[model samples]
Target chain A: MVKKFMALLRMKYIEMFAYQWATLAWSTGAMVQPIITMMVWINIYETEMESFILYFSTLILVERLTAAWDVWDLDRDIREGSFSNYILRPIHPIHWAIAENIIYKGLFLVVLVPAWLVSSFFLPSLQLHLNGWEWMLFISALLLGGGIRFMFSYSCGLLGFWINKVTAVYAMFEGISLFFSGRIAPFSLLPPIMQDISLYLPFRYMIGFPIEVITGSVKGADLGYGFLGAFIWVLIFMGILGFLWHAGLKKNQAVGG
Target chain B: MSIVVDHLNKQFKVHVRQAGWLDAFRSIFKREYQIVEAVNNLSFTIQSGEIVGFLGPNGAGKTTAMKMLAGLLHPTSGAITVEGFIPQEQKAEYKKMMSLVMGQKSQLIWDIPPMETFLVNKAIYEIDDNSFNKTLDELVALLELEPLLNKPTRSLSLGQRMKCELAAALLHRPKVLFLDEPTIGLDVDTQEKVRRFIANYNREHKTTILLTSHYMGDVTALCKRVIIINHGKLLYDGDLDVLTEKLTPYKLLEVHLPTLPNQSWETYGEVDSIEEGKVTLRIPRERIREVSARLLQEFPVHDLNIQDPPMEEVITLAFQEKSHG
Candidate 1:
């Protein structure tokens, strides 16, 4: 099984390289949003501009690492009857999606790390000063965030089995997540009510909490809460993912080619 | 028995809507649905190493029945067991033992060479390195895929791609194969090549195969026993020759003469066509011997030949009979 999984991962890695230009284009496009947001906020809060640069730069890297777009591929497969190929196989289809996610993140990070380093030199505020323990916690939080976000997106994608078009629904969720997950701005900079709400919601745990951890903005008891929140949300999303997968398989029309 | 399907039925709940803005809008809130019996109370069984042709016209439930058997679609009701495994359960062991190839649906990675897809299937099926290499080599040799395996799937011709598809499906050496229209659009030569490969593979591997195709050549070449279905119902199930004999009561007789005969040819048989020096007639199967002898004695006949009506004609007649009934 491990051999099979490793093969799948390697195959996906090679496939990604085959479309190197597209991967580069997507990575470049992803950086645009965070860079633009950083520029806008740097002008707004002159004194805290350094912190803004650090937060958004980390956000850019984290977003690329945690991103999961299997939903689009799933939607197309369902519509085109390509999903039946996976169904006929002994293997569960999600492994292919997981392999793709890991490959994309691995390749994207290679590009992102260098980009981050170069930008840090140009933008002095983007540098990070973190202790070893903080680095450990940050890495853990980053992985948890990626897991939560991936499951969340995948669960939403499973809606395609029930509905004809899931894009509108996904877009709605993404619209809300942008504000709540700190894609637009850090949770602390938001209104007090939104910040309080983000604390309980899963969105912040997916993106913002990890950034906060790595930036050393979250600490002490608050750091404990962040970890707890991430854990609970991951469990909730994973549970939802399990339910959705079962329900989706049952509902699979297995539309003809 | 390698396969058993008892009272297998599949019904699809299809939404009904008329062509109008109001009806389309109304359907969103209170849509009406009608149950379509795609496969109705179908039942058949095949022994190990037997190749059965699933004969049907468009919308005749052949593909649906095959899909259910392959575990791609759930049957509405009834039981199906292939190799003691209920297909609907889709257990790993069952899936590992069976493979389905739809000619219209490709499993290949279009952007890459077919070898990549084969490797992916190798992992997906979890075949050991030794077995995988051996099976792939055998398949490649059998399908004549040595030259095609390295070429990108998009660049390969349709016939070449289908060969690769077959190779991909068979890499695991599935015990039972469901082939749905495996030669649908190939040229005559390619079709013959595919048929020969399928026959040779079945003989060598003793793979239980259930094939569905509109082309009678495929059925005639590969299947001794055929199950005919029309309108989601079984019309006949027996030896292919027996079905043909039962459905068709007549044979075609063509007579070539040195000169045109003025006498009416109806006395000989039902004249299908009469040309300058040749006359074609549909004669009863029982009278074929008698009719040919009489025609030879009566006409200035240069030559005469008797042939069974085409299989396509027999199948069409069978379907027609069902519709009339």
Candidate 2:
């Protein structure tokens, strides 16, 4: 099983390489929203302009790592009958999606790390003061956040098995996530009610909480809450993922190609 | 037996809607659905090492039956066991023992050479290195895929790609194979080659095969026993020759004469066609021998030949009879 997974991962990596330009274009496009948010906040918030800049820059990096677009691919596969290839095999189809997610993140990091480093030199406010333990927790939080986000999005994708167009559903979820997950503004900047809602929901753990951890904004008891929230959300999404996978397979039409 | 399907039935709940903006809009809230019986109470057993041709016209449930046997679709009611394993359960052991190749659907990775897909299948099926290499070598040699293995699947011709598809399906050495229109659109030469390859492979491996093809030549060449279905019901299941004989009771006899005879040819047999010096007659099968001898004695017969009706004609007649009833 491990050998098969590794092979799938390698195959996805090769496939990603074939679309290297498209990957670069998408990553570049992803940076624009965070950059625009930072620009607007810098002009409006005179007192915390530098800190906002630092936070949004880190948010861009974290967003790139945690993004999962497998729902679109899954929807297409179900509609076009390509999913039969995976179904006919001995392996579950989710492994292919997982491999694709891992490859996309790995390839994005290749273009991101160097860019982050070079931009940090130019942007003095980007520097962070983090202890060793804090750095470790931040890395762990990133992995958990990515996992939660992937499972959550993939669960939404599984809705394709029931509905004809999942994109509208995914778009609605994404629209809500954009505001609650700190894409447009920091969680602290939201209304207290919205902030409270974000803390309880999985969206904060998916993107914002991990960024807060790395930026030293979340610490002490809140740091533990951040980790716990992300871990619990991962567990919750994992449960939902299992149920959705079973139900989706049962409902699969296996429509003609 | 390699496969046993008893009282198998499959029904699909298809949404019924008429064209028009109002109906389409109303369907969103309260859609009407009709149940379509794709395979109805179908039953057949295929023995080990036996090649059976599954014959049907479009929408005849042949593909649906095959899908149920391959474990891709669940039967609404009935039982199907392939190689002593329940197919719908989709056990790994069962999957490893059988393979399905759909000529219309490709399992190969289009952007990469077929070898990559083969390697992936190797891992999925857990074929050991030695067995993988040996089986791949044999398949390559048998299918003449030496030159096509390295080219990207997208670049290969349709015939070349189909050979690779077959190789990919057989890499694990499955005991039972379900082929759905495996030679649908290939040229005549390529079709002949694929038919020969299937025959030789079946002979050597004793692998049971259930094939569905519209081309009668494919069925006639590789299969002796054929099971036919129409409207999700079994029409016939026995020897191909027997089905042909049962559906068509007449043989065609063409006689070439030194010149056009002055007498009416209807007295000999029903004149199907006549040109300058040749006349084709449809004669009853029982009187074929007697009529030929009499014709040889009665006229200046240059040459005479007797042939059974084509398999396509027999199958069409069978379907027509069933539909009319």
Candidate 3:
């Protein structure tokens, strides 16, 4: 399995290079919304520019790290029947998607980490101050966040077996996630009720909770609860993914085969 | 038997919608569905190392059956066991032992060279480096893929991409290969090359191959046995020669004569066509010898020949019989 995963990672890396422009465009373009949101908040608050800058920059990094395109891929492949190529292979099809995620996110880190360091040298707000344990906890939250988002997108993609317009459904979910996952604002700035609601929902864990961890807004029992909520959501999404995979295979018409 | 399909069946629930916006909107609220029986109670067995042609016309459930055999779709009912493994179960060992190639649906990564796809399969199938190298070398030589290996799949011609697709699918050395229209849309020369490669590969590897093709030449060249189906029903399954002989129990007699006959030739046999001094007759197989002799004696025959009906004609008759029955 490890050998196969490495091979898949290598293949996906090469594929990324083949579409270098698209990869660059996507990885860079995704930052625009958060950066724009950051500017708006900075102007509106007038005094909290540094914190707002830190918040949105970290959001950009965390969002890119957790981004998943499997829904779009699955929607097209399953509908067009090219997905059967993966299905018929000895390895499970999900491994390919997972490998792709690892490679793309690894690339994002490689590009964004240096960019963040350089920006921090210019703008001190971009610099993070945290102890070793805090850094470890933040990294754990980021990985968990990525896992949640991947499972959610992949599960939504599996819906393509039953529905022709699965991407639209996923788009609706993504729009909801925008507000709930703290992309537009920090989780701490949300209205009290919304913050309470975000605690129980998985979307918050996908992007918001990780940002909260790094921003130092989630500490003490809230930090414990954040990890607990994130872990629970991971299990829930993993369960959903498992059920969807098995059911989707049975539902699969293997269209165009 | 390398493959055994016992009463295998697959049915799809397809939405039925009419044209126009109102109907589409109504369908969104209240959709109707019809059950499409893509494959129904199909039972057939193929022995190990046998290359059997799966013959069918458009929408004849050929691809559906192949997909079921390849474990790409779940059968609505019944069962399919390929190499002692139930295909729908999709066990890893079962998958390791079989491969499927759909000419219309490519497995090759479009933007990358096919070698990358081969390497990916090597890992997915856990093929040792030695075996992977050996098999790839053999396939590359046989398919003449030395130059094409490094080119992007999208840049290569359809024939070249198909050769790469074949090579990629075979890198695992599967024991049973399910080919759905493997040579579709290729030129005659490329089709012949694919056919020869399939035949030679089957011969060398003793792999069980179940192939479906619209082109009769593919079947005639590579498969002595064929299984014919239509409307998800098995119409015929046996030797290709036997099916032809059974469907068309007559031989075509062509006579090259110095002059045309004046009287009706109905007394001898059914006149299929006549042009100038050349006459063609459909004579019963039992009487072909007698008819040929009489034609030679009376018709000023220069040369005469007897031949079975073409495979296309025989297969058409088989389908017609099923439909008309």
Candidate 4:
């Protein structure tokens, strides 16, 4: 399994380079919305400008690190019947998607880490101040966040076996996630009820919880609760993915000859 | 038997919609579905080291059956065991022993060279270095793929890409191969090359191959036996020559004469076509020799040639006979 994953990663890495300009554009393009939101918050809350800058900057980095596009890939592949190629292979198809996720995220890290460091040199608010334990916890939360996001996207993609418009359905879910996952604003700024709701839903664990961990907004028992919530969501999505995969294979028409 | 398909069937629930915009809009609210029986009660067994042509017209369920055999689609009812392994189980051991290639769909990564896909498969199949290198060398030489291997799949011509596809599917040297339209849309020369390669490879490897192709030349050149299907059901399953003889039990006799015969041609045979000095007749198999001899004695025949009916015509007659019956 490890050997297969390594090969898949290498192949994905080469494929990514073939679209290097597109990769660069996508990594940089994702920053626009958060940066624009940061500017608006700065104008609205002049006294708390530094904290808002820190929060949205961390949001951009965490978001990039956790992004998943497998839904689009799966939807297109299932619709075109090219997915039969993977199905016929000896290895499970999910490993290929997982490898692609790892390669793309690794590229994002390579590009974004330097950009964050250079920006921090110019703007002190962009810098992170965390102890060793806190850094470890933050990294754990980030990986968990990435895992939850990947499972979520892949599960949605598996719905393509039943529905023709799965990407459109995923877009609807993504729109809802925008407000609930703290993309537009931090969870602390949301109303009390919305914050409680976010805690129960899986959206917070995907993007918002990781940002909270890095920004020191989640500490003490709250940090434990965040991990607990994220862990539960992971198990839930795993269950959902397992079920979809088993049922979807039978449901798959394998559309094209 | 290398592959056994018993009462195999596949049905699809397809959404039915009319052509106009109003019906399309109405279908969004209240959709209608119709069941399409793509493959119905299809049963055929292929022996080890046999190359059998899966013959069918468009929408005749040939591809559906192939997909089911490859375990890509679940059969509605029936059993298929390849090498004593149930295909729909999709076990890793079963997959490692078989390969499927669809000419209409590509397995190669488009923007990258074909070598990358081969490397990916090598890992997935866990092919050792020595075996991989040996098999790849043979395939490259046979397919003449050394130049095309480095070129991006998108830049390669259709024929070149197809050769690479074949090589990719065969790197692990699968024991059983399922090919659907393996030579579709290629020029005659390229088609002949692919046919010859398949025949030679099968001969050398003793591979069990079940191939489906619209091109009659592919079947005639590579397959001695054929299983014909129509409307998802098996119509005929036997030797190619036997099916041809059964459906079209006559020979095409073309006689070249110095002058045109003034008598009615019906007394001779069924006149297929006639020109100034050349006449073609459809003669029954039993009387071909006697008729040819009599024509030579009566009319100063310059040249005479006798041949069986074309494969396309034979298959057409087969379908017509089955449907009408």
Candidate 5:
């Protein structure tokens, strides 16, 4: 099993590097979104660079670091039966999907690093309060956040097993996430009750939880509690996904129409 | 050491509907179903290292049976085992020793060269570098894939891509190969070449090859033994020569004489066709020798030949026998 996992990882690495040009294009596209958000916020705040610079830059940082691509790929795979190839491979195909996710994430960090540094320099007052322990906590939260996001989105992809076409459903989910996960605007800027509600929901933990860690709002015991919630949600995602996949497989075998 | 299939059956539940948006909408809430017995009570045993041709017409459960052996589909009520492993168990060891190649379906990465896909499989299979290189080199040479290996799969012609597909599927040197129409849609020369490669590869590696193809040419060329199935039931299973004799009691004889003989040929056998100086006759299998001898003596025979009834006819008869039964 260990050897097979290593092989899966190696295959994913070779695939990522082979398609390096497209990877570059996509990561560039990811960076551009945050950079544009940074510019728009700078114009909006104008003179008040204090909270504006800190919050906006941290938002961009969290977005870039916590990106997940499998949600989109997974939906397409389920639609076209490309997932059949994954199903037939000897090892559990989820490992390959996860390996692909890690590769794309690793590549995106490289793209975001220079942009992060340059953008910070341009915004002179931009201050990301970072110390060793806090930075380590932030990194952990970011990984957990990415994991939670993948699980939720992957479960969304599973909807394809029941529905003939899931594009409209997936699009609606995306639209909800754009607002719900603090992608378009920070949770605090929304109605106060909505922000508090997001804290318990998986969607906020997917995006908002990591950004909160980055901005230093989540500290001490809060960090541990937040992590516990994230892991629990991950477990929930897995449980639901397992039930759905088994049911879908039964349906597939019964008719195979 | 043997593939054992006993009373294996597959029933497909298919949605019944006709075209048009209104029908589609109505059918969504109120759908009808029809049961299709793709394979029923089919039983066969194939020892290791045997190359058997699995012959059937379209929608005749040929692919469904192959899928069962490959562990892709579950049998409805019967048992299928290979070397004591229930195939549907799909043990990793069982999968490691088996390979499936469907000619119409591809496993290669479309945007990249086939060699790249081979490398991916090499990684997935965890083949050591030395073995991977050795096997790849041998397959490339055998399939004559050197020139085609680096060309993107999308760029290669159908035949070229199929050669690559064959090589890719064979990289692990599987012990059992399930080939579904592996030479379908290829030119005659390419088809012949593929058949020769399969024969030579089976000879060298002693791989158990179960091939299903629409082309009778494929079976006539590669398979010495054939298993015939129709409507999910075993129609016949035995040596190809014996099958021809049992299923078709008659043989074809083509006569090319300098001129039409003055004597009536009906006394010799059933006359199939007569054109100009040529006459084709169908005679009972038992009477072949006597009929040929009599024809030579009676007619000024320039050239004469005896042949088995065409495979297409035998299959048609097999289906008729099946449906009637």
Candidate 6:
């Protein structure tokens, strides 16, 4: 099992390096969103004499670091007939996809760490100082967010079993994530009650919860609740993902074999 | 030491359809199902290292049978064992022992060199570096894949890519090779080259090859025994030469006579066609010597030749007979 894991890691790095230029383009796209957010928030702070602007700019920093990867993998695999090749292999192709996500997430951190440095340097308002308990809560939220995001997107991919054209579904998923994940604006900035409503949905837990903790939007009791909410949603999505996997395999036709 | 498929049966739960939009919508709500008996009560056994050709017309269940043997598709009701192990178990050891290649589908990664695909297969098969290199060197030399190895799969011609595909499938040096129309769509020259490669590979590795091909030459060149099926039923299973003898009992006798014979040609054999003063007759295999002697004495024959009916005729006749019965 260790050999398989190590081999998978090696393969993931090799594949990522081969498509390094594509990765660069992707990271650049991700970077542009945060830069645009920072500019807009800085302008908004020009008028409002409040600390909310500090949390808003910090929102940009957190969103830049935590990016979701699902639509691209699912949409491309559906478009190319290459998915057949994946299904034919003895090993479950999901293992490779998981390894690739791990590699991409690790690589994203490289750009993310430097981006954090630059943001804090230029805009001191983007940095948040927290106690040890706060840090623990924030990391836990992020880990739970990863699980929620992976399982939800995987369940979306299994829609391939029923629909031949799944790009529309993926497009909708991406569009919703961009808004609900707080990439457009901080979850707090949505509407008066929208923040409470967002907490009930998994999308907020996937991206918004972690970002909220990092930007110090969550107070002592709220931070604990956010972590708990993320964990519960992760369980829900995990169940959904497991069900979709078994159902998808049963419905598999093995076309053109 | 042997592979056996006992009472093999396969049924596909095909969705039934009516041709209009309403039916299509109704099918979404309630689907009609039909069971297609792809292979029914089929049984065959093959010993180790014996090359058997599976011959059948389209939809004759050859592929369904091959899929069963490869453990890709489950049998509806049957038992299949290869070397004392059930195939559908699909253990890593069982997968390591066999390889499958389909002519219609390719395993090579397009836009990348074949070597990349080879490396991927190496990783999947868990082939050690030393064994991988040795086996790859042997396949490269045998398949003449050296030139095609580095070129992107999309750039290589069909024949070249097929050679690489074969090599890729065999990189693990599988003991049983399920080659489904491996030489399809190749030029005659390339087909012969691939046929020779399969033959040589089998000889060197002592691999058990169960091959399916539309080209009879592919069957004759590499396999001495054939299992002929028509409409999912085995029509004949034995020596290829014996099938020809049993199905077609007559030889085609073409006589290029010096001049037209005024006498009736019934004494020689059944007259099939007489054109341009050349007479072609079909004579029973047993009467060939005597009939030729009598024909020579009676007619001013310039050239007389006797040939067995083409194997294509025998195969067609086998299917025709099965189709009726």
DockQ per candidate, 2 decimals: 0.69, 0.58, 0.88, 0.88, 0.35, 0.29
Proportion of native contacts in model 5?
Answer: 0.18
User: Which tens-of-lDDT digit does each residue in B169-239 have in candidate 5?
Assistant: 88888888988889988999889889999999899999999999889888988888999888788888888
* Interface RMSD score of candidate 5: 3.6
lDDT of 3 by residue, A1-257 (tens): 89999999999999999999999987899999998999899889989999999899999999999999999999999989899888888888999999999999999999999999999999999878899999999899999999999999999999999999799999999998998999999877789999888888899999998888888888799899989999999999999999999999898899995
lDDT of 6 by residue, B1-325 (tens): 5679899988878889999999999999998999888888889999899999999998899988887787666677989988776766656678777888988778886656788788877888888999999999988887888888888788898899889989988988888889989998899999999999999988998999999999988988998999988666788889998988888999999999867867788878999889887999999999999999988887778998898787778889988988888
Poorly placed runs, candidate 6 (over 4 Å): A1-25, A30-84, A106-144, A159-163, A166-179, A190-201, A219-221, A228-250, B16-33, B253-281, B292-308
lDDT of 5 by residue, A103-161 (tens): 77777777767776787777665645588987887788788878777776666666676
| Whole-structure CA lDDT of model 5 | 0.78
TM-score of 1: 0.96
- Model 3, position A188: C-alpha lDDT score: 70
Docking class of 2: medium
Q: What TM-score would each prediction reach against the true structure?
A: 0.96, 0.96, 0.97, 0.98, 0.90, 0.82
TM-score, candidate 2, is 0.96
Which runs in model 1 stand beyond 4 Å of their true positions?
A: B298-303
DockQ for the candidate 2 complex? 0.58
- After the best TM-score superposition of candidate 6, give how far the Cα of residue B264 lies from its true spot, in angstroms: 8.0
Worst 10 residues of 5 chain B by lDDT: B83-92
* Candidate 5 wrong stretches, greater than 4 Å: A1-25, A30-61, A71-82, A125-127, A158-162, A242-257, B261-264
lDDT per residue for candidate 6 within A50-165, as digits (tens), equals 35445544454444444556645655564443454465456666676677677877887787667767767776664668889778877787778777777777677777765666
Error of 4 at A220 (Å): 0.4
Give all candidates' CA lDDT scores. 0.87, 0.88, 0.92, 0.93, 0.78, 0.77
Stretches of candidate 2 off by over 4 Å are B257-263, B275-277, B298-303
Docking quality tier of candidate 5? acceptable
- Give me the displacement of residue A79 in model 4, in angstroms: 1.0
Query: Which parts of model 3 have CA positions greater than 4 angstroms off?
Result: B257-267, B275-277, B298-303
Residue B185 displacement (Å), model 6: 1.9
Count clashing pairs, candidate 6.
Answer: 0
